[model samples]
Each structure stands twice: as C-alpha cells, then as structure tokens.
Target: MTKLTCFKAYDIRGRLGDELNADIVYRIGRAFGQFLKPTTIVVGGDVRLTSKELKSAVTNGLLDSGVNVIDLGEVGTEEIYFATSFLKADGGIEVTASHNPMDYNGLKLVREGSRPISADTGLADIQRLAEENNFPAVTQRGVYKQQSVLGEYVEHLLSYINLDNLKPMKLVINSGNGAAGHVIDAIEAQFKARRVPVEFIKVHNNPDGTFPHGIPNPLLHENRQDTIDAVLANKADMGIAFDGDFDRCFLFDETAQFIEGYYIVGLLGQAFLQKHKGAKIIYDPRLIWNTIKLVEENGGEAVMSKSGHSFIKEKMRAIDAIYGGEMSAHHYFRDFNYCDSGMIPWLLVMELVCTTGKTLGQLVNDSIDTYPSPGEINSKLADAKTAIARVRAAYEKDAVSVDETDGISIEYPTWRFNLRSSNTEPVVRLNLETRGDKKLMTEKTEEILALLRQ
Candidate 1:
C-alpha cells in the first residue's frame, strides 16, 4: 500500500506529479464514494490547468462507484459548498489547489449539508480505503450530468444585503485571474438589474489558468499591488481580491490600505450582531480581543475555537452560531449551512458600509486603534517546538492566564498573544494584541520574536 502525502489535516493538497495526479484523485473519489456511500454528489473545479482533468477523473471514479455526479463546470470552491446543500446532494468535492504553487493541486470535500470531511471526520478513513485500493466490482453505474447554479448562488449572496440601501459607490475587484471573476460578473448583473448604484472596476478579472498575475494570492504583499493600484487610480470606495479558488477574499479601504483580517472579523461580527441579537459568534484563538469585545458589547456570545476551517465549522455547528470568522480571512455563516464562504464576508461588510453611511476605513479604524495588532507573524525556525516552549516558559511565569486550545496563549491584563507551530513545516505563527496600546504591542511583539528566534 502506498501512503498518500496529499492527505492534509483539513483537505488534500500536494505537488502535482509526485504527490497528486488524476490517478490518485480517481482513487480519492472512489474512496470517498465508498466511505460515505452517498447516492448523489456534486463536483467542481477551480481555474487551474489541471483542475478539469482531475475533476473528470474524480467524477468517473465516483460514477463507477455507483454515485451519481452533478458536475458544476469551472466554479470556485464555495460553489460546490452551495450546490451540495441547494441540490440536496449527499456530498460534494472541489478540485482546487487554492493559492498553492502552479505545480500543485488539491481537493476539498464535504459530506451532506456541506459539512467538511476532515481528518477526524472521515478523511483518514477515505485515505486508508484509497491506499488499500480494494473495491468490489460495480454492477450498476451512476449517472453524470453538468449544471450551473450561478443564478441561485448569486441570489443567495445578495440575500445578505438590501439592494435599495446601497449608495452610489465604485469598488475595485481583483480576481487575480482566478475562478472568482464569473461570480463577480453574475453579481454585477444582479446589481444592474435591480438598479443598485454599485459600480465594479474589475482587475485581473479573466480566469486564465496560467495565473498571469502571480498565482491569485492577495495575502502576499507582492501580489496585492495591482488591486491597491487599481483602487487608487479609480479612487474607489473599496478593493477586494481573492485567491485561485476564490475561497478567501482580501479587502482594502479607499486609501488603498490593506485592512487586516483581524479587524474584518470585528466588523463582520458587529454586522451580524446588529441583526441577530443575542446570537453566538465563533472566532479563532490566534486573535481574540477585538472580536470578543465587539461580540460582547453588542449583546452576543463570543466563542473561541481552534484555528482551521474544520474546527471553526464544527464549533459553529455545535454552538448554533450565527456567524464565525478567522483572522486568516475565512468566514462561516449559519444561514449557509455553516460553511465558510469567501464571497459572503465582503457582501456583508459592504452592506455595513452603506447602512452606517461610513467609509470602509471609518468602519474598521476604531477597532484597529483600540486593539492594535500586527496581524499574524510567521517565522521559520528549525526547532519550532523548542522555540514555542521557550516563549511560553518566558511568558507563562508572569501571565495571568494560559490557554492551550490550539496552541499556547498567554494573557496579561492589557496584552495577550497566541503561539502555534505549523503542522507540516518549521514555521511558528505569532498573533499578539494590546488593549488600546500600540507601543506595548510593538515592544512585546519584538520581545517575543527575539525569544522565539533565539
């Protein structure tokens, strides 16, 4: 039996030839079909060059296993999530490597109701079955069909905001030549039909699998310059950018300054709390102060979950949370079957902008000032564990409280920080926040970085 290195903690991600391929992907589809035994499944792919071939292979495997497949041709990851529940499909899969390098490709899977299938929730078992490569012969093959849920998906997104409330605004949307362009186009059409006054300035809007603008990952500062420049040139109200699969969308304000995802969490939390009072909100442990304060002040319960989509989704489902967000730019909604969407967050945030009669910067600047942070800082060290231990030992002695939910979080009255090591690499991530004290945040961040590096 061969071990599949593509099976990651949450999804399948790996190099194309050596780790992931059409053959291995077919095995995964068969294995998934066998594991869940779902009668019907939905499948889709991103704008990667290999995505179509891999999607076809996986669909064939699923069909051979007696699972009918509804193929959503050339869509973003969230489209699969939406179609799974909308079509009442028993399962769904998206062949996407997201922001990974060009030579890599991956898959994201979900069970009924679009619940994620991660390591703890049938991923490991699927991996085992695929590795075993032992399957009973199929007597009856399942049907295969192609469909587009673009209309329904766009309407669902628009449901979050009122069309009449939208003011005249010009926004820059940079798809980075990924799968998000089509969805943006559909939304723009809806806006025009409804006579909404939002004008979209598209940048890198075409879905070129070659990723002419460097891989569609706006998280990298180097890749964000185009979106920022477009925002500045147009003097747009806001700027939005997405990765290859469009599962995560980054934002910029009128000044073309990138707004940290940490503050977006607070902004979105407040937006939901406005309508869904007394609702529960879930957030990750990496960054907390701003979100917790916003939720609590707005008469909502704030729950902390371990970082990662699976963990956050599970916690959101268990707690019946109205909304959940991560500093990494992933947002989950209860209305959307508790699934994370890169599309929903911006819509909700834009709604907030119009209703409050505030600029995007005005909406988030207060939180940034009150809870100063450097966002998430990553450092590569050979001995990540030892470095984490070193920082914890140094801080725990003087800390008021220590939390080990995902990693180790040390808290003081005015400042708190969480340190977690990468599950697959020699990288340590640090997220620190100060209670209205930028100087203290900077000083402490430097001090902790020094200790971890040492």
Candidate 2:
C-alpha cells in the first residue's frame, strides 16, 4: 500500500505525483465510496491539467464500489455543491487545489446536502480505508454520466440577488486564466438578457492550467495590482477577482482600493440581515472583525466558529445560519447547500451597491476604518509550537483574555492577535486587528514577531 502524506485535517492536497497520483486517487475514490456508501455521487474538476486524469481514477474507484458517478466536467467547486443538492446526490467531490501553486492539486469532499467531510467527520474513515488497500467488492459496477450544470448554477446564484433595480455600472473582472472564465460567460449572458447595464472589462479571462497571468490568488499583495490597474484604466465602478477554482473572490472599490474581506463580510452580513431579520450569521475568529458588531447592532445574532472551509460549513449547518463568511474571502450561502461560493459573493455585493446607490468603496470604508487589521502575515519558523508558546508567554500577563480555539488568540481592550500553525506547511500565520489603532497594531505585530524569533 502506498502511503499518502498530503491528507491533512480536512482535504487532500499536495504536489502532483509526489503526494497524489492517478493510482492513489483511484484508491481514494474506492475509500470514499466505501466510507460514505452513497447511491449517487457528483464529481467535478477544475482546469488543472491533472484534474481530468485524477477524476477518471476517482470515478473508477467509486464504480468498483457500486456507487454511480455524475460527472460535471471542468466546473468550479461550488457547481459541484449545487449539483449535489439540486440533483439530490448522496455525496460529491470537487477535484481542486483551490488557490495553491500550479504544481499542486487535490480533492474537496462532501456528503448529502453538500455537507463537508472533514478530519473530524468522515475523512479519517476514508484515510483508513485508503491505507488498508481493501475496498468493498460489488457484483455490478455503477454507471458514469456527463452533464453541464453551469446554466442552472447561474440561475440559482441569481436567485440570491435582486436583478430588477440593478443600475448601470462598468466593472473590471480578472479571471486570472482560471476556472472562472467558463462560467462568467453564462453569468454575463443572463445579465445581458436582463439588461443590467453592467459592462464587464475582462482580463486574463481564459481557462488555462498553466496560469499565464500567474496564480489566481488575490490575497497576495503583488497579485492584486493587475486587477486594480484595470479598474482604474477602465474607470469601472469595482473590480472582482477569483482564486484558482473560483471558490472564493476578492474585490476592489471604484478607486481600485482593495476591499478587505473582513469589511465585505460585514457588508454582506448587513445585507442578509436586512431581509432575514434576526437571522444567525457565522464567522471565523481569525481577526477581531467588526462584522460581529455590525451584525449585533442590526438585531442579528453573531456566532464565531473556527476558521477553515470545513469547520465553517459544518457550523453553518448545525446552527441553521443564514450566512457564513471567513476573513479569507470564502462566503458560504444557506441556499448553496451552505458551501462556499466564489462566484456569488461578488454578484451580491454588486446588487448591494446598485440597490443602495452606494459604491463598493462607500459600503466598506466605514468598517475598514472602524477595525483596521494588520493583514495575515506568514513566517517560516524553525518550530511553530515553540514560537507560538514563546509569544503566548510574553503576552499572557497583559492579555485580558486568551483562547486557543484555532490557535493562541490573545485579546487586549484595544487590539487582538491570533497566531496559528499552518496545516499544510512549516509556517505560522499571524492575524492582528485593532479598534481603530493602526500604530498599536503595527507595534504589537512587530513585538510578537520579535518575541517569536527570540
């Protein structure tokens, strides 16, 4: 039996061939089928060169275990979630590495209603089944069928936003040559039919596994400038960018100022609460988000969950929350099976701007000012645990509160910071935020880094 190194606490991801391959993926399919015992499974893949081959291997394994596969080829991750719930599939899997580097690819799995399958869920069972190399035998193999769910997906997404009163606007969209381009055409077709009066200036809007415009991740400061430049040059109202699989999106205002995901969370939370008063909203505790304050102020309940896609989705389902958002730009919808949709966040934000007669900049500016954040910083530490412990000891005395839900989150009256070890690499991630105090945030960030180094 071949060993798998990249099976993390949640999904399976690693450099191609070294940690994942056709044979191992085949075994994973059998393992997943054996674990879930689903009658029908929805499978989809991104534009990565390896995705098709991996999907084939996974399908064979599922068939061998007597589980029928509905293949939605070359679709985004959220589309699989849409198909699973719409088609009433027993489970689903999306073959994607998300915004990881070009050399890596992997799988995101879920069960009925698009519920996530994580380490605490069925991932451990799948891992055990894969490691044992013994899959369930069946008398007959299940069938495979190919379908395109993009049209239905677009319609489903539009249902969340009011298209009736959307005003005339020009927007810049950079797909980064990822999987988003294929579906953007469908969405644009619908917008045109409805006469939304929005002109889309597209850049790098092609599905290329080679990533000619570099990786599609906008969280990196250097990668966001192209979209910002396009927005400024075209004089567009806003700019939207997608990650590799288009499962998360990042936005820039009319002036090309990058709108932080934290502010977007608050903005979207407010939008949702307007219609569903007193609805529950879930957020991750990576930063001291003013989104919680905004939600509470608006007569809605705010619940904090641990970070990560799997954790947020699970909590959303458990609490029956109306919306769930992460500071990293992942927004999960109750309608979209509570799975994160990189496509819908921007659409809803556009609707918010159009209906409210405010620019994206105006909607987020106040919140950004209220809770300034240091932005996530990653450090390649010699030992993550030791570094975290040293920082914790240094701040323990002054911290008004300390919690290790995700990592070491130390809170002071004016500022707070969360330092957690990365699941996939030997690095520690630090996220700090303040109550309108930028200098203090910077000073405390430096102080924590210095202590970690010592």
Candidate 3:
C-alpha cells in the first residue's frame, strides 16, 4: 500500500507522473469502492491527456470490487454531478484537474444525489483505505458499460431559461481547449434545430488535451485577454470563458470589460430573486456588501457560507437557497441539485440580458459602481499564519465587526477585507470591498499588504 499525497480538503489533485498515475488511481478506486460500498457508480473524465488511463484504472478497480460502472467519456465536472443525480447512480467520479496546469490531473467525487465528498465527508477515509491497499476481491466482478448523457444534460441546461424569450444576441465563447466544447456544440445544435435566436462565435472551442491555447484559466489576467480580444474583434454582445472542466465560467461584457465574479454573484442573485421572492441566496464571505444589498433590496434573504464548495453547498441545502455564488466564479442553483455549473450561469445571464434588453455591462453597472472591489489579491509569505495574526491584531480593535467564517474577515463602515491563508499553497489571499469607496478600498488594500509584509 503506497501512501498517496494527492487527496486535498475538497478533492484530489496532483502532478501527473510523480503524484498520480494509473497505479495510484486504481488503488483509489478500489479504496473508494470498499469504503462507500456502492452498488453502482458513474465515471467520467475531462480532456486531460492522462485522464483516460487513470479513468480506465479506476474503473477496473471498481469493477474488481463488484461495483458496476457507467462510463460517460470526456465530460465536464458538472456532467458527473448531473449523471449521478439524473441517472440515480449510487456515486460518481470525474477525472479532472479543473483549472490546474497542463501536467496535473485530479478527481472530483460525489455520493448519492451529487453530494460532495470532501475531507470531512468521506475523502479522508478513502485516502486511508487506499494507502492500506488491502481490498478483498468480490466473487463476482462488476460490469462496465458506456452511456452518453449529453442530450439529457443539454435539456437540463435549457430548462433554466425560456428559449422563446431569448433575443438574437451574438456571444463569444472560449472553451479554453478544454472539455466544454462538446457540450457547447450540443447546445448550439439544439438552438439551431429549434431556430433559437442566439448566435455563438466560438474560439478555442475544440477539446485538446495539450491545451495549445494555454490552460484556459480566466482568473489570470494574461489568460483572459484572448476572450476580451475575441469579444471586441467579433463585436459580440458578451463573452464567456470556461475552465478545463467547465464547472466554473468567467464573463465579459459587451464593452470587452471582464466582470468580476463578485458582481456576477449579485446579478445572478437578483435574477433568481425576481422569480422567487424572499428566496434564500448564499454567498461567500470574501465579498458581501454588494450581494447582501442586492438580495435585500430584491426581497430575498442573503445567507453567508464558508469559502469552499462543500461548505457552500451544505449551507445552500440547509437554507434551501435558490441560488449560491462564490467570488471565484462558481455558481450553484437549487434546481440543479445544488451543484455548480459553468453552463447555467451564462445561460441565465443571457436570459436576463434578453428580457431586460440591457447589455451585460449595463446589467451589472449599478452594482459595480455601488460597491467597487480590487478583486482577490494573493501574496506569498514564508509564514502565512503570522501574517494573518498580525493583520488581525492591527485591524480587530478598530473594526466594527470581525468574522472567522472561513478566514479572518474585518469590517468597518466604509470598507471590509478578508485575509485568509490558502489551503494548498504558502500564500495569504486578500479581498477588500467598500460601500462605494474605491479610493478607501485601494488604500486599505495597500495598508493590509503593508501589514502582511510586516
């Protein structure tokens, strides 16, 4: 039994050959099958070059343990979620690294009803069992079969919006040479078949394991310029970019301005609240002023959750939230089994634009102006804990409120910031926003940076 180092707080991720390979993945599958003891499971993979071999090994492990496997080849992370719930499978696994670099791969696992399998849930146990690598084989091995859920998944996405209400708008979609191309093509085909008035201008739309156009991470400023440039050059109404697995999507407005996930959260919250008055909207603690204000003004309740997807989904399920969003571009919906989807967000945003007859930029203009933020900033430090402590000590006394929800969050009347250390790296991330004071936001951001340096 080899001890694996890829299991993380949320999911599994690691460098290709050194940390993860077919051997390690097979052990993980056996361990998962032994631990969860599911009768049947759904399996899928992203477009990563190494995912196929790893997925095959995982399937073999599950089958050897008498767990039937349903294979959905080359799919997005959300597709695993959908297949798990839609097919009523006992569990699901997607071989993906989600926005990680080229030479990395990982797995996102979920149990019945697409419930996330985090550290607290069942990942730690699986990790321990995989390390032990002692699994008694079943007398009868399980079976493996292929299935395509693309049509059903496309139908699920279209269920979010009324196609007749959609206006004739041209959109620039950057698949980032990842796994989103197939699904995008599926949806476009449906639209074309129905004569829906949506025009899609695709770039880097083909799924390439090599990632010839880079890793498709829109969070990086350098990675986002292509989408911006494409939107401008095509004169499209808006632009959307998806990560490797297409579970999260970033948006750009008609003006070629990148819309931060903070404002998009507010925008999406408002969109849902308009239909379901007094519905609960879940948001992370990193940036809250805009989301809180929008939810309350629209007759909806704003609930705050911890930073990670597991925490957010748990909170949403508990509160029966109609919608939940993170500043990192993850958007979850109640109708979508409380799972996040890169495809749903853009579809809903387009619906809003079509119904309101407003540009994407115009829809979010008020919120962006009302509460400006510098976005989340990260700083590498030798000692992140000491830096966090120092920053807390300096601001705690003068702050109107302090929250330790996921990290250290300090709030004053005009500005607020959250300082937290990364779970995966030796870095502290800072996000600050103000109630209409960009200058104060910038000043406090610098002040926080100085404190971190100290």
Give lDDT: candidate 2, residue 143: 92
Worst 10 residues of 1 by lDDT: 421-430
In Å, residue 331's CA in model 3 sits off its true spot by 0.7
Sliding window of 10 residues with minimal summed lDDT for model 3: 419-428
lDDT of 2 by residue, 93-149 (tens): 999998898889999998998888888998988988898897656688999999887
Q: All models: lDDT?
A: 0.92, 0.88, 0.92
Per-residue CA lDDT of model 3 for 343-414, tens digit only, reads 999999999999999999999988888889998899999988888999999899989999999899999988
Model 1 segments more than 4 A misplaced: none
Q: What clash count goes with each model?
A: 0, 0, 0
> Residue 83 CA error for candidate 1 (Å)?
0.4
Ranking by TM-score: 3, 1, 2
Worst 10 residues of 2 by lDDT: 131-140
Instruction: State the lDDT of candidate 1 residue by residue for 163-273, as single tens digits.
Output: 878899999999999999999999999899989999999999999999988998888999999999999999999999998988889999999999988889888999999
As for TM-score, the candidate ahead, 1 or 2, is 1
Off by over 4 Å in 3: none
**TM-score of candidate 1 against the unseen true structure:** 0.98
Q: List the residue pairs that clash in candidate 3.
A: none
